[model samples]
Target: MTALNSKTITLKQLAKTIDHSLLTPDLNEEDVKAGCELAARYQVASVCVKPWDVRLAAGVLAGTDVKVGTVIGFPHGSSTMETKVFEARKAIEDGAVELDMVINIGAMRSGQYDYVRKEIHEVVEAARGKALVKVILENAYLTKEEIARGSQLVEEAGADFVKTSTGFAPTGATIDDLKLMRESVSEKVKIKAAHGIRTLDSLLEVIDAGATRVGARSTAAMLDEFAARYPDRLG
Candidate 1:
């Protein structure tokens, strides 16, 4: 994998790493349709839908190279490991190519590192070779030590990616968390900065800190603002 740098990759390349999200609880068919259209228009990597919408998202993106991604254990990682594994398998069967599982924050806070690591491993194992697993740290609820420890545990558990936040937390990805995660994992392991990262400055900070992927619903808005301010750059 390539490291984050000032040089921009192609839209196709950028899209390949993005998980275009529409995770609101009140989402409907219309919202999914709009999300799919925007995802295709932006050439985003995947459309991250709710579990029930995975099949719908899969059908909408069937003819395109765009993949389907879904959440497991959702905004909170408080679900039982058994339930999370079941959700992961079911989502893959529903045509999801990527699985973002929320880590059990409660367990981590209790210093049950083994429990946290085991939970991540269960989902990863359940994903089998069918779906890529991204473990969400929900960084806003965690301390620096917790972030570092969780990143390491995620690495040890063999997840494909370690993510910063769920966007529902009090805070989201920070430069410190991204830097710590980057320094903790191997080059092959990917790092994603999500939540509360809506501006170009913050994005650049995380990217510079070594986050290869970013999860943001405001990507389209941010791109529009960028194009307006730097018309020449858009060319």
Candidate 2:
């Protein structure tokens, strides 16, 4: 992987790559608000809050470049197709500009490729161009071949991005997984890395591996480090 010139990358550029994640189940309304505030302050790419918070987050991030994003079929992708579509539609109506949807992991692992593809396609259709759809493959439960096949399915379904994990899985994004996903899809399909990205070095590793976006709860610490290293680039 070719390295990103850390010296040349500004804080704004790095911030734009992050989706400040606030998906923990125990978080309250105040927590969501604070997370949105943090995202606004740093001007990150988006704030990926829980589905219920999409309207609130949208209100907070209005007029800013920071987009409002939410998940569909979430940590587990067992939800029925109709439910997932409804979730996507409601999120979009609530001002979510991005939707990170989980694929049917059990079905995918069972080699139900057609079912998985159809589900993703339905969700994409439901978004109706209102939001950029990201299909999460949950790589922790899949082999390399499955990951590759899943990426292809996402591209075929017309989703905007292929993602690594749901962060509720046993493990998160890896350099190898990111590279494999990148190779599996064309340049038109972007890649997002979520979970366990806690430091500047780790974040850069994923970026070099081909991830354009990352989901993380450690936004402040990571950006603070970048600020310390490149004070002039802060924006």
Candidate 3:
């Protein structure tokens, strides 16, 4: 990865690359609203919330550039393909512009590559071009070969992005995983690095490693650090 000088990247550019996360299980309506508000204020890429909160988040972030995103099958990718498709359709109906769907880790580990690929394809079809689909590989459990294969499956399955982790796994996105994923996918397939990216330096490192977007719960702190370090660049 090439070194990125913080001075060259504007605050807005950095903020735009972040997908502010609000997928915690215990979060209530108030929490979702607050998260949406924060994303709007910060002008981040999107507010990735739970499936049920898509409408509320859309309402809160209305008139702002921040999009409404939701997870399908959530932390665990065990949901049946029908259920995931339903979730994708419902999220889009509820105004979610992006859908981050998890692949069946168990199935992938079991060598059910065709099943995983078909599931992703169905979810993308369910979106019907209304939302961008990001397929999460949950790399914490996969071997390097699996990661590479998953990246190929994502491209073949027509997903817009190949994500590193779901953030609920035992581990999170690593530089090596990001590098491998980048190498595995085609140029058109974007990368999203989620989990364990809490600091500005970490975010930049991943961006330099080939991530076009990120899922972050520490959106405020990181952006604040960027603003403080380059006050003149931030409006």
Candidate 4:
């Protein structure tokens, strides 16, 4: 596991951008609870776990500043729109503060732009202003044009954030993709550069390219290294 030890030198600054993750298939309720505890201890931005565990995380994190987050149609984005929407609404009702929904790769590849748009909007609507909606574009599977188009569609669908990958794909977030995504969206929308952001240089590149958030499981180690390297910069 990659640690959050970064050259930034400050826990407070690093935690603000990290989204503590616990999305592996083998992760059980106990693991999720432990992850939530770690996130709370670190005071990271949020704790992202399986959709089924959103309520549990919320219950554990209640009355705290840490937000509860989960993924919809995760790992695979091939699920029907109805299913994704159903999952989104349920997760929100279960106390999820953020929804990260993956886009259907086949539909996007087939040039079914409108279909993708509607799918995202469906989930966004289901969120009902309770949770922030983030559309994961799976950038590795698409061409540059497709990435740009996906970003536009996500923006049009009223999503709060546009994400790079689910990390199950062949490739993860890249600097080029981050630039394209940032360029494609409105300034009001946030850009999250996730997927294999294991190093300080890599994470900084994304932030410099306008990524306001990062999904990472290695918050603890990365921030530690960052703090050691740049002790004076961090609070």
Residue-level lDDT tens digits of model 3 in 1-235? 3333344778988898899999888999999898889999999999999988899999998899899999999888999999999999989999999999999999999999999999999999998669999999999999999999999999999999999988999999999999999999888799999999999999888988888899999999999998898888785
Worst 10 residues of 1 by lDDT: 6-15
Q: Which stretches of candidate 1 lie over 4 Å from their true place?
A: 8-12, 226-235
Q: lDDT value for candidate 3?
A: 0.92
Q: Which lDDT tens digits does candidate 4 get at residues 37-106?
A: 9888878889888988988999899877999999999988989999999999889889998989999999
* Model 1: lDDT of residue 219: 67
TM-score of 4: 0.93
User: What is the C-alpha local distance difference test score of each model?
Assistant: 0.83, 0.92, 0.92, 0.86
What lDDT score is found at residue 56 in candidate 3?
Answer: 95
Assess candidate 4 and give its lDDT: 0.86
Superposing all C-alpha atoms, what RMSD in Å does each candidate have to the true structure? 1.9, 1.9, 2.0, 4.0
TM-score of 3: 0.96
* Local error of candidate 4 at residue 35 (angstroms): 0.9
| Candidate 1 residue-wise lDDT, 32-145, digit = tens | 988988888777778889999999999989888778999999989999999999999999999999999999999999999999999999999898789999999998888889
